[model samples]
Target: MKALKHLNKYFFQYKWYLILGTLFTFISNLFGVVPAQIVRYALDLVKETISLYFLYDGFGAQTVVYEIFAFSILLYGSLILIMALLKGIFLFFVRQTLIVMSRHIEYDLKNEIYHHYQTLPLSFYRKNNTGDLMARISEDVGKVRMYVGPSLMYGLNLISVFILVVGYMLSVNAKLTWYVLLPVPFLSGSIYFVNTIIIRKSEEIQANLSKISTFVQEAFSGIRVLKAFVQEEPSTVAFTKQSNIYREKSLDLVKVDSLFTPLVSILAGLSSVLVVYIGGQEVMAGRLTPGSITEFIMYVYMLTWPMIALGWTTSQIQRAAASQQRINEFLNIKTDIVSTKDISQPIEGAIDINHVRFVYPDSGIEALHDFSMHVKAGESVAILGTTGSGKSTVANLLCRMYDTTEGQIKVDGFELKEWNVQSLRGQIGYVPQDVFLFSDSIKNNVRFGSLDMSDEQVIQATKDADLYNNIMDFPEQFDTVLGERGVTLSGGQKQRLSIARAIAKSPKILILDDCLSAVDTKTEHQILNNLQEIMKGRTSVVISHRVSSAKLADKIIMLDGGHVIEQGTHEELMAKEGAYKELFEKQLQTEETNS
Candidate 1:
């Protein structure tokens, strides 16, 4: 009931269409039963007219009987033709209204789910799988549509037809009506029992399908790695195992349906046999006429569909309910990262991290401990650290990707929580270590950080990142569509493109986190020189392991574990003969050895 309530807005929004469709369904079913009553009347007329002709035994009596029979036949034929035409017309409109309404609602729900996904925090994405989410939006939403459209339409039609047919049957013979409806209770019980199994099986099937989707999505995303490591066969085996589980779950659902459908048909068949046997005996006993028995049988036949439809509609509702629950779970997630609704103030480049502590949710390990730093407006600071030393964690905290567990992070005297999240992120340019480029043209990828950036700005950023010549050498140049994740470009080229994207944003604060690792030393040095002039007035945090990258910063901080071990200017840190100096000497020796 709660799941159904979630869909009420959509239902009410299109109530007019639903009401019209239901009205047409009622009219169509009404016309459908009229033909059966007409047949009964025609039969009774023929029997009475023949009896009168036998009694009179004259030419006049015979002529009257012939005229009555001819009129009755014409009336029945006309009623059949008119009723069939009306039923067809109304049924078409019923489908058009109800089915189309379901499609519209489906479209709305899909968009709503997608919009909800966009609002969710990065933590929510880490906890959920892309494949599972995709299955909910696609397959689960489809199941819900089945309940809204065809299932609702057929269920309503069954109830309307059942009521009219049963009322007419009772009118003809009350005793026979009781006997004909004996199997209904059993059928209802069977539907209730089977629906439980169907619901359980449906959930399992949906879960397994999500597994298959997850496996396929991961496999395709890492196809390059699989081929490079010669692990394609192993990946195929894993996918096959997941596929088999999906197939087995689907077959379990099919087995339940197979058993339930036949049981429903058998019960309907029993009702028909009971009506025929009992009504035939009543006819012979002179208590009921042949026409009444014929009408009773026709009503029993009409009841067959509603009984069969009971089982089908129950299954559809159960499956839809299971799917709705999954979708509701996703929609109900509370995003941990949200900004003050009323605040839209822009941030300045000044950053202050005061006694901050942070831990990753999944790992339960502290990424930063009592970490504190202050960057004056327009200052360039470099973070130098080894792997697992919290270099990237600092950058993430600064961007509010994950909020600090303790203390405060302020930008230009305002706390991080006080600023609108989108507004805060907009002012910062962040280039991650693992660069991700969309499968789009080079120009579009570079312009992604700031969609409204001009072409001249994009070209200048590319030149600054040392990627302009590489782009122009291509046939289509900026218009050339990149393969998935810019696979066509070299590692260095991809890294430079990521840098160009960030530069085009014209951000007040820029954080480049090991973004130049793929490029050679000479190329890295050239790019850094170009960026030096650009970073003059902007607050910049350059995070890297290489000493060359840190040496260019006005101030450098060296971290070990989750704590900062040293902080000073490049010359001051080198002169101290500490961790910074040791790293610098090692890199210089490696360069000399390579030369």
Candidate 2:
């Protein structure tokens, strides 16, 4: 309930709907009770009319009695119909207002979560998986909707109907009402005992279901890998084992869940028995009418459903509370990154990394230590390193994916932290090593860098990336839709498409983190030459292991174990016979061997 308080603002936003819905509940219940009263009145009138007919002793008043009785029955029957109609209309309004409000809240809540997700730093994604995040936003929110919609609506109906129906019963005969209620304590005790078990089992079932869902989602996504390894039989066995666990937990819940109906039916039967047996004595003693017994029985049956719904509604509310707590946990988390001011000006791509040091917070592994670099506007610099050399970390910092643990990075003479996050990212085009393309048309994938890019610019960008001929060969050309992560394309094609996407925007600064590794030397040379033209006045940083990628840069910096070991032009580095020359020769020999 404390966690559920987060929804107070939404409830207040839709306060009028709640107020009106609640009002309708009572109004509907009020009309609902009137029908039972009408039944009692008609029954009494019938008995009195019959008694008067016998007392008249065939005085020819039989026709008058029959006509009067018939007319009264017709009038009372019409009134009962009117009562039922009014009750149903109010129930309709109750759903219209309450249920609609819940749906609106659902929409608002999902958007809020997704918007927050966008603001969080990359570290958050590293710490959590897609399935968990999706479940919080989708499944948890649906549970909350159930609480706000059906649980709330039915709860109000139960309170309204129970009070009105019980109050009227008491007014008719207090003693008989007490007798009919004898089964309530027994039912209450049984519910209290079973409810604890139901709550525990429900939680287990939900957890197991989430686990199974994640397993199934991952299996489908990696079906190709599974088949390649020939592990389908083992995978099926594992899945079956998980499914059996889920089934066992579900059956346990069903055992407790299935108890409510018979328990309610039996209790309601007891109440009816009390009504008929106890109330009949009152009628015989001339203290009550047979109509009174029938009314009490009708009220008992009327309360049956709400009584049966008790455990279900309680469990629903509890689950909703738990789910809302999960939602609140994410919402309350402050994003590590925040957008700074000064977004009005454009960057000129001058960059300075001053003795920067960074360590991954999750693993506490240092990625960079005392790294420094300087690049003037329009100059291309290449950072050369092998795996674990922290070359990619330099790109990540430039994109502001994570802040440096020591020193500071400046862009256009201003610190990276001082610039607006969005404005800063917009100026830099980054092509990551891991190329990810959406399941969308090739045109849209290229246009992702800038949605408003002209088609001509997209075509030119693809040409520059050396992928124009291949795209044109496809059946749909620009409209060709790729599979998940662009699996339809070859590895080199995917990498080049990612390059095209980055260059499509014509950003002031370009950061390519080994994005050209998948292509051959010939294609790499062609794209690098094309980039030389596109980056004529734009700053560029290429991080790669290949010397071919770094030889053309205005300056090359080679890194080893997170520290800069050498920095110079290609001619100067070769003259020195240092580490850079050694690496360049090694890669050159490998390329020659492959050719």
Candidate 3:
């Protein structure tokens, strides 16, 4: 209930829908009472007319009176039919107002969650799996819709129909009405006793479902790896084990859920028996007329659907409450990476990393230790390090993906955090180690960073990245649609396309973090040569392990285990007896050996 309280705003938003739906509910129930009243009146009329004919010994009045009675019955039967038809029409309008409003709320909730997902930091995604996130937005929200739509409609129907029909029953004969409603307290108690267990079971089912979804998502996403390792049989066994757990959880819930309908039906059956026995006694005692007894029976039957439906409505509400709690858990997580400053500032590309120390929040890994670097506007610096030496962390910092744990970083003499986050990221073009491409046309992929890029600009960016020739060989060229994650291209081609995407943005600062690892030295050298012209008058940081990629930089820094081991120009580093010189000689030997 605490979690479901989150939906109160939506209820207020669609207040008119609820109000109108309530109005229709009352009107429909009123029509139900009218038909029952008409039946009662017709039955009493027949009884009275037949009795009078018998008292007079059918003195030729019998034939004429019988004919009139039949005519009156037919006319009353038509009125009952008209009332039923009107009730159905009002019921349709009830669905239109309430159910349709639920859909609008669903649309709004989905958009709200998706927009929040976009604003969440990368760290948030790290702590949560994609499958769980997807489930909350899709499955969880769907359950909430059940509560707002069908559950709400049926609940109102139960309330309005019960009130109107029971009130009429009291008017006809209060004693019989009390006997018929004897089941109400027991029903209420049964629902109360079952509520706690239902909620607990629903929560377990939803959680187990999330785990199953995550397992399937991972299996499908990594199917290629499973086949490559020849572990398909093992994967299948693991999946079967997980599915068995889900099945058990579901069956436990179904065991409890299966009780609701039968329980409600049993109570309703008891009500019918009471109407037959007690109402007959009342009629014999002259407390209730035969017509009144018939009306009481008819009203009890009228209440049956709303009574039987009450259990289903209660179950859906419990499930929805459970699911809504899951959704709110994620929605309440506050992101720590939002911008503190609201002002935008121009970046001249001068950067200073003054004794910065940083650790990854999710894994608690110290990626950078006392790292310090200085780059003037238009200068190019290459960070040379082995894997896990924090070369890529520097790129992440410059892009403001994560702030430093200990020290301050500044761009153009302003603290990184002081500048608007969007403004800061927009000015930096970063090509990370893991290249990702959407399943879109080649031209659109290249134009991803800057959507307004002309075709000529897109072609030139690809050319600079040394991928224009490869794209031109394709049937559709720029318009060629890529498969999932750009599977249509080779590894090197994908890397080049990612590079093209970055450079197309024309940022004030450019950072390439080992993006050329897939390409051969020849292609790497060709692309770097083209980048030399592009890097002019803009701050550039090239992070790589290859000496060939660093030789042309204005400055070079070598790192080891999150610490800077050496720093100098390529010429100066080669002049010294240090790790940088040793690495350069070894790389040069490898090239020579390959040649």
Candidate 4:
């Protein structure tokens, strides 16, 4: 019911269209019923001919009666043709307009969902499945479209048919109409009861469907790993289990639907039999004309379709309601990253973290406690940390992907939340660990960083990232198309491309999170050396697992368990004989052993 209310708001603006559509449908049904009544009259006229044969004294008059019957048939056929033409004309505009309206709704919904997704904290996506998100934006929105298009109109049509049939039936004989309608209450009760069960089953089915979609997407993405590890048998077994669950749920849906139509048919059929028996007796008792009795039976048959259509529409609406609930759940999630009121100053990259404590939203475990750091404008700092030492968390905080739970972070002497998010991001350049390049020309990918950048500027940026020679190697040069995720490029080439993208932005602050991990030691050194010259006087925060990479920084901070254990130059850290010294020694020993 709540879902219906939500869907109704989208259709509210088009209420006039719906009213006119219903009016046309009502007129079409009115013409439709006339043919059935005409057939009843023809049947009575044939019955009269049996007795009138004595007065005519010959079968020649039968030709004239036959001609009269043929003309009646032609008139009913003409009425049917007109009704079809009118319904088609009305439906043409309705369907065309409604489809356009549906497309508009779909576009707005997808845009809002994507915008909301972009503003949400990184932790939200970390806990949610990518496939499920795709399903909501693609499949769930389609469910809303189904309701708007067919289910809504079919539901109204059922109502119109019911009113027309019932009114005509009651006008013929109120007592007989009551007897014919006796099965209606039972049918209605059965439908209401079964709908509850169907809705519950549908929710479970939808959940399992999401799981299946997630599994398939994961399997395809990790196909290379599965083949390398020879895990095909296990994957097949898992896939079979999910597929079977889907099959079982689908069968349950079919079973419930099967019961619905038969039940409605039985009730309608029972009413039909009662009307025939009771109305036939009224004719024998001289209380009703034979033609009137035939018309009553015609109306009963007409009632059958409305009853069936109503039940089917009810079931479809219930499924759509379930889909709507899931869709709204996604749409209603609060974006965890938003700016506070009364703040809109341009940032200058002077970042300060004061007694800032952080926790994961789902786990509530502190990722960083009493962590404090400061970066003066145009300062270059390198962060060295182990696998889970909150190195990425620092970068994410600076990017405003997540907010501090227990302290304050300031940028340019103003609170972090006080800055406009877009302006802040626009001023910051981020090169992530897994370099991603769209399947586009190198020039376009570079220009994504700065949309208005000229080709000459892009060539200069590529040269700064040490990628100019590589781009010129291809016949198409800057216009060369890379495969998805730059699959056509080598690891070093992809990383260099990302560096070029970041440099193209010419940001005030640049945070590179292990973006050069794939490059060899010599290439890494060259890229870092080039960045030093190009990134001079820009606030730079480098996150790296390798000590050699941190050697280029003015100051290196060693982090352990989300705490900064040491902060100094390479010589100062080695002289302290602390965690940093031990890590440096271990790396030297590993290198010697590998040699």
Candidate 5:
């Protein structure tokens, strides 16, 4: 009942269409009832008498009999015609209404789920699969649409028809009505039991299907790796296992459904047979007329469809209920990160982290411990660390993608929480380790970073990122379409393009997270030099393992195990004989050996 309440908003919006459709269905069923009544009347009018009313008795009943039969035929024909017309009109409108309603529901549900995903942190996606999430948004939502459209209307129609038929049957023969209803409780109870099993099996099947989809999605995405490693057989085995599980669950669902309808039909049939036995005896004993018995049988037959429809509706509702629960679970998740409703005044790039402690929510492993740092406006600082040393965490905290567990972060002397998260992020340009590009023209990808920028501005950013020559080399130049995720470009080209995107933002602060790893040292140096001039008076945080990259910064911060170990200029660090000096000397020896 609680789950059904969710549908009220949509139902009320289209209530008028549903009301008209119901009215037409009722009228159609009423006309459908006429044939049985007409049969009973015609039997009473002519089953006896006959012989052309004993060869024209004048006013002795021949005229009366013929007229009664003629009127019955004419009345039933007209009702049938009207019913057919109404059915067609109602059906068309009902279909259109359901389609329109389902479309809106699908759109809104998908958008809500998608927006939730955006607010969720990177860790959430890292722990879940691409295929599983895709199935929930696509397949699960599709089931809800099916429920809203056809199942809802058909279920309602079934109830209305059942009520009309049952009432008419009781009026015809009260004894026969009791006989028919004897089996209803049993049949309905059995259907309810089967429905429970169906819901459980359907959920299992959907879960397995998600796993199978994930396997296929991952296999195709990493096809190159599988080929390189020559692990096709192993991959095939894993895929087959997932497929088999999905198949097994699906078959379990089918087995239950197969038994459900047959059992329901048998119970309904038993009731019909019992009704005929009792009503036949009544007619033989003259307690009820033959014409009345005929009408009762017709009503019994009419009852069968509604019975079957009831069972089907039960199954559909059960499946939809399960789907709704899963969808609701996703929609209810609360994001740990949310900006204040009201933003403070904008900043001019001074950032201070005061005694911050932070951890990934799910893992509870601290990524930063009592970390404190400060950067005045226009200061360029380099962060150096080995893997798992919190270099990226520092950048993420500054952007407020994840909130600190303990301590205050301030921008331009204002608390980070006081500023709108989006506005603060807008001021910081970021180039991540993995570069992502949409399947669009190169010009469009660059323009994405600054939608309202002029063409000259775009060209200048591309030149500064050292990607202008690469874009011009293609036949279509800046207008060339990149394949999915910019697959058409080499590693270095993709990295340079990402840098171009960041540069186009004209940010007050730039954070590059090993974004230049793919570019050669000479090109890296040239781009860094160009960036230094452009980034003047704009705070920057450059993260890298390369000493050459660190050389470009005004000061360097070295970290080890989520804690800062040293902070100084390159010359000062080399003179200090610490971790920085050791790493730089090792790199120098490697370069000399290569030379």
Candidate 6:
């Protein structure tokens, strides 16, 4: 019930529909209970011994019993027919209004969760899996809808029937009504006791289902790796174990449901037996007539449905409570990266990192410690470092993927936090080491950064990245559809495609973080030559391990252990006979030996 509080706003938004649905429910139940009273009157009229005093005096003197019976049949028969028709009509409206409202709410909730997912920080994604989140959005949302629609409607219907039927029975005979209702309190207590267990088991079942979803997702995504390592058997075995766990949890929930329904049925049966016995004794004592006993029995039969419905409705409510709690947990997560202040002006690409330090949330060691650099506007600086030397960390910081833990980062003289995140990111073009492309055409992939990019612009970006010739060789060229994650392309083609995407953005600052590691040296040199022209009058940061990639920059910085070890022009560094010169000589000797 506490978990359902999140939906209060939506309920209020569409309160009119809910109110109408409740009204229809009440009217439908009102008409539904009228047939029992009609049956009572018909029984009294057809009795073998009729009291003339109870009938109209003129009709009693003028008409025979056969004439009275025929008259009663025509009048009561028409009334019952009309009541049934009205009940059916109101029931239709009740279903239409409340059920459709639930679907509308489901649509809104799905969109809200998806929008929230987009705004969450990258760290949040790192902590949660795709399949688990999908379960929250799809399965959990559906369970919540059950409570809003059928559970609520049926619960209200049960209450209406209880009140109307009980009032009618009490009017006829209060003492017999009390005796027949003896089992109700015990039945309600039983349902309450069973509901606690059902709620706990339902939560466990949903969690295990999520685990199975995650297992299937991960298995399919990494199927190629499993086959390559010849570990398919082990993966299958693991999947079977997870499936078994899901089955066991589901069976446990079924067991609780099995117990609840039968318990409710048995209690209802006891009430019916009590009604027959007590009412019979009253009829024999001359306190109640036969027709009155018959009417009381019919009312008890009507009450049976509400009791059974109580069990089913309670089960739905408990299950929905468990699911709503899961969904609310996700919706309540506060986004860590949100703009607190507005920046009106666009950014210029002069980046300054002033003694910044950053540590990943899950790792205790710092990835970047006391690292500082400055690149003026229109300056092209190359970074050279071994693996784990904070080269990529610098690019991440400039892109604002993660904020600095210690110091300040500024673009165009504005602090990273001072500028709007989207505006700041729009000016920078970053090509990461691991490129990711959608399953779309080459042209669409290149133009993804700017939806309004022209075909000519896309072609130009591909040519600049040295990918135009490769794309032209395909049958459909730019219209060719790619496989998942661009798996149809070779490694070098994928890297160049990534470059083309960044180039198509035409950003003010371009950061290439070891994006050319797969291409041959000849192709790499040609691409760099082209980038020299494109990078003119634009700030650029190139991170690479190869000297050939860094030699074209106006300046080069070498890093080790998250600290700058050297910064100079290529000729100046070579003349100084330092680490850069040593690496250059080593690479030259290797090339000579291979030749």
Report the lDDT tens digits of candidate 6 across residue range 229-291.
999899889989988988888888778777766776787778778777898998899988778
- lDDT per residue for candidate 2 within 1-595, as digits (tens), equals 7878988899999999999999998998898888898999999999999898778776888878888999999999999999999999998999999999899988988998899988889888888767668777888888889888888888888898889988999999999989888888998898878877865665566667667777887888888899999999999999999999999987887778788889889999989988999899999998889888888888998899888887677667777877777778778888766656555478899999999999998789899999999999999999998999999999999999999999999998888888889888988899999899999999999999789999999999999999999999999999999999899999999999999999999999999999989998999999999988988899999999999999558999999999999998999989989999999899989988999
The better candidate by TM-score, 2 or 6, is 2
Give lDDT: candidate 4, residue 305: 78
Q: Which pairs, if any, clash in model 3? A: none
Decoy 4 TM-score against native: 0.91
Tens-place lDDT per residue, model 4, 70-101, is: 67667766776776677667666656555556
lDDT of predicted model 3: 0.89
RMSD of each: 2.0, 2.2, 1.7, 3.0, 2.7, 3.1
lDDT of 4: 0.81
Q: Please, what is the TM-score per model? A: 0.95, 0.94, 0.96, 0.91, 0.92, 0.92
lDDT of 2: 0.89
Q: Sort all candidates by TM-score, best to worst.
A: 3, 1, 2, 6, 5, 4
Model 5: how far residue 424 lies from native, Å: 2.0
Q: How many clashing pairs per prediction, in order?
A: 0, 0, 0, 0, 0, 0
What are the lDDT figures for the candidates, one per model? Answer: 0.88, 0.89, 0.89, 0.81, 0.80, 0.86
Q: What shift in Å separates residue 581 of candidate 2 from its native position after superposition?
A: 0.9
Question: Which pairs of residues have clashing backbones in candidate 4?
Answer: none
The digit string of per-residue lDDT tens for model 1 on 1-595 reads: 4676789999999999899989989999998999888888888887887888777786686887777778878978998999999999999999999999999999999999999998887677888899999999999999999999999999989989988888888888888989988988888787788888999998888888888888888889989898999999999899889888888888888888887668867877787788789988998888788788788778877877776777777788888999999999989987778775536665568989999888888668888888888999999899999999999998888888888889899898888887888888888999999899999999999999888889999999999999999999999999989999889899999999999999898899999999999999889999999999889889999999998998568899888888989999988987999999999999999989987
Better of 4 and 6 by lDDT: 6
Q: Which ten residues in a row have the lowest lDDT in candidate 3?
A: 334-343
Better-scoring candidate (TM-score), 2 or 3: 3
